[model samples]
Target chain A: MPVLRGFLWLLGFLLLGETLVTLTGLPVSAGVVGLLLLTTWLRLHGGGLGDIAAAAQPLIAVLALLIMPGVVGAFFILDALEGQWTAILAALIGGTLLSVMTTLALMRRLMGEASAPGEEAPP
Target chain B: MTALLDHLLATPLLAIALTLAAHAAGTRLLKALGAPAWCPPILAAALLLAGVLALLSIDYADYRRGAAWLMLLLGPATVALGLPLHQQMPRIIALWRPLLACLPVAVLLAAAYAVGIAWWLGAPPEILAALAPKSVTAPIALGINAQIGGPVSLMMGGLLITGVATVGFVSLGARLLGIHDERIIGLALGLNGHALGTVRAFEIGPVAGAFASLGMSLTGILSALFLPLAWRLVGA
Candidate 1:
């Protein structure tokens, strides 16, 4: 299928995911669940989604562009966000750093890689 | 002419145009600056857009309406994650155990860290609830927060902060930890970074991007299922 069709195919899965989220009371959003469903579908059928992948690359390349409105919408809650700024920013910082360290440690232990080398990270 | 220009500027399309231009400029600037991983392109672009809108005295709602179509595509863009996940199926299956073992602990620690620190700062329970799923992507985080009885607006703000911080700090962390493997970098970023990290993953390379997508999906699925339940049961 052409890229447009590929887009429609992805859109179709998104709709299905939305429907599932609504009907099944799934905890996650339709989009992520839909991605899971699509992956499962492709894996089951011997896995050929390169067409859609290629089609979506352009859109994904600019994914950040699509996310701005929501960030800007952060304006809506600015008043609520005021007093909590310290806590919120701190939690985010702490959570993020902790997540990286924890994941790295766990993955290192599981993969059993020696963590003793390469202090000089590439720029 | 001024009336026509003013009318055009007021439309949603202008929002889209401004965002695209800012992103392009940000991308170019990053490339010129040797594309340092710490300086997120999206953050730069968002800052630029936010600044311009502030200067122009435009409301976020108007910008959102102008860019409604783009926002709607966030779903499809997320669905597009399947493409990469599908491509990475073999590796995904092979690394299933490591993923399963590592993600739960990692996600739990993140949620705990977020909520714990916030609660210590005397933040309300709803804010704590919103912060629980901060590591997950925005869409899934929204669902997770809703389940946990969090305030939706707070969750959005928290998720954005998590994303920007993830994008900004991953490289620095890698440097300090001496972690150089692309797979590890990508996984760490996507695991914690959410969509912004996925974008960073793609920025570095396709292989990293693929792994980052996997990390992102795993984190989302796991956190969505586990965080709310754990938060309630554990009384954290």
Candidate 2:
């Protein structure tokens, strides 16, 4: 039953994702939309999703590994990137620093407010 | 024998095997080094694999032929993020007002800061455009770059770097500030780090992971909607 339930959930997720992708024409990917749909249904229904989520977690956990091959392709393009190295470096270093600063500032503000009187910090 | 060896090497299965091996070795290395949980195995694997490919002078297309299955999984994995968001809906609902306010601000700040700094550093126009969407996840970031005529390779590099830096630094930043709340930490990581940050959050705890996933998904949407307009306003 657990196995069957898992399969069904996977099927549902894929189907919904495909349907939404076909419909929306938005930039968001279909699989992402499918995941959102499943999540919403699981949240509202609260059935056997915990088990399903548990099963899916490990696969999703190592997702970065899945992109590694694609990233390795970077080596092949080194010469092309070489000519533009300065610009690439600027974008990476500059973009990263800005993201870090922005993240820190927002977190500080949110934490400050949420910690205000009587509202216990969320565990 | 050489033809058979080449065929076996060219298969996607080989790429998957290599990736798994690299990831396992990288994680073990990090553990041995007592690196924090936020040290991403993926980032390590990418670096190591790039070195291997370059040293051998293998064509990327051959590597990609083997590794493209990884791309297929990206969609499904992105969808699965919904489960965590669903679990955390109550907390998300409670913080809706602040979250709503924070979403656009966070999105704009990330996009602007990346572009502004890139420009200030004298990056070329194409590089600046590519950096504009670096905070979002790969699929969306790639799409946006393509649409805007940015360099796809540069954007991919930016995405990987952004992910690693966010994962690497968020925990250290939180520890430095003496702020240990998992939810806040996760939110910050997700908003800036995207998927890589969310993975880091999961190591902290389920609650942190949940919030991180929520923040990641929302940030992707928010950035997609507002980033272009923000870019226009900045005249970039």
Candidate 3:
């Protein structure tokens, strides 16, 4: 039953995402939008998505590992990257700093207080 | 027959085997260095595999053949993010207003800043377009690039670089800003770093991981909805 619920959650989310992408023409991928919608719905209803969430946790935990192959795909185009390494490095550093700053600013505003260094929030 | 044998033996399966071996070794090495949390397995794997491929003179296509299964797993892994989001739904709902407001602003700033810096540095249009989606997750970044006339391959590269850099520097940046709150640091990392940031968050603690997941999901959604409009405003 737990497995069935997990599978159903996956199926339902993918279908919902597909429908939204087909209908709305949003720039976002349907899968992502579907996840958001499912999350919202689950939260609003409460306890409904519990079984599925439980079943899905292990799968998601190692999600990063799954993308390793794609990362390895970089070898296919090493020459192209090597040629543009300078621009690539600059973009990465500059973009990352910019993102960090923007996010920090947003956090400061939202929390309305300075957070202590290395203080983990309560769960 | 010799060529075929070599191809079979030096395939992506070999690459995967090498990567996993490197990750195991790297983890132990990192732990020994007293930097357990900073042991970036992907980066280590990439470096190790690159060395193996260069030494063996094997083409990437042969390697990709076996490694492609990893890519396919990406779709399911992304879908699995739904479970975390679902579990944290209550907190997300309570914080909806602030989350929504912060998301668009964060997405726009992230995209604009990347493009702005790239243009100032006289980067090519292709590179600039790719950098525009650097802060978003790779899957969505790929979609955004396609929508806005950017090169998907370039965007993927940008996404990789961005994720690595974000993961590398997030803790340092937080400390520099005197941010002691793990939740904020985690949320900020996930919001901007995507999957890579989430990994970092998990290293910090469960609470940080939860916030990171929350921030990542909200940011992905908000960016998807608003990036197109942002492109139009810039007349791109």
Best lDDT among the predictions, by candidate number: 1
- 2 or 3: which has the higher TM-score? 2
Q: Ten consecutive residues with minimal summed lDDT in candidate 3 chain A?
A: A114-123
Q: Which should have the higher TM-score, number 1 or number 2? A: 1
Looking at model 2, residue A55 earns an lDDT score of 54
Report how closely model 2 matches the true complex, as a DockQ value: 0.48
Q: Evaluate candidate 1 by giving its C-alpha RMSD to the native, one decimal.
A: 3.9
- Rank candidates by TM-score, best first: 1, 2, 3
Cα-based lDDT for every prediction: 0.78, 0.70, 0.69
Where's the lowest-lDDT run of ten residues in candidate 1 chain A? A114-123
Q: Mind sharing the TM-score for model 3?
A: 0.84
lDDT for predicted candidate 1 compared with the true structure? 0.78
Q: Which ranking of candidates, highest DockQ first?
A: 1, 3, 2
Interface RMSD of each: 3.7, 3.3, 2.8
Candidate 1 true-interface contact recovery: 0.69
DockQ of each: 0.49, 0.48, 0.48
How many angstroms is residue B22 displaced in model 2 relative to the true structure, after the best TM-score fit? 1.0
Q: What are the TM-scores, per candidate, against the unseen true structure?
A: 0.90, 0.87, 0.84
Docking class of 2: acceptable
What does each candidate score in C-alpha RMSD?
A: 3.9, 3.3, 3.4
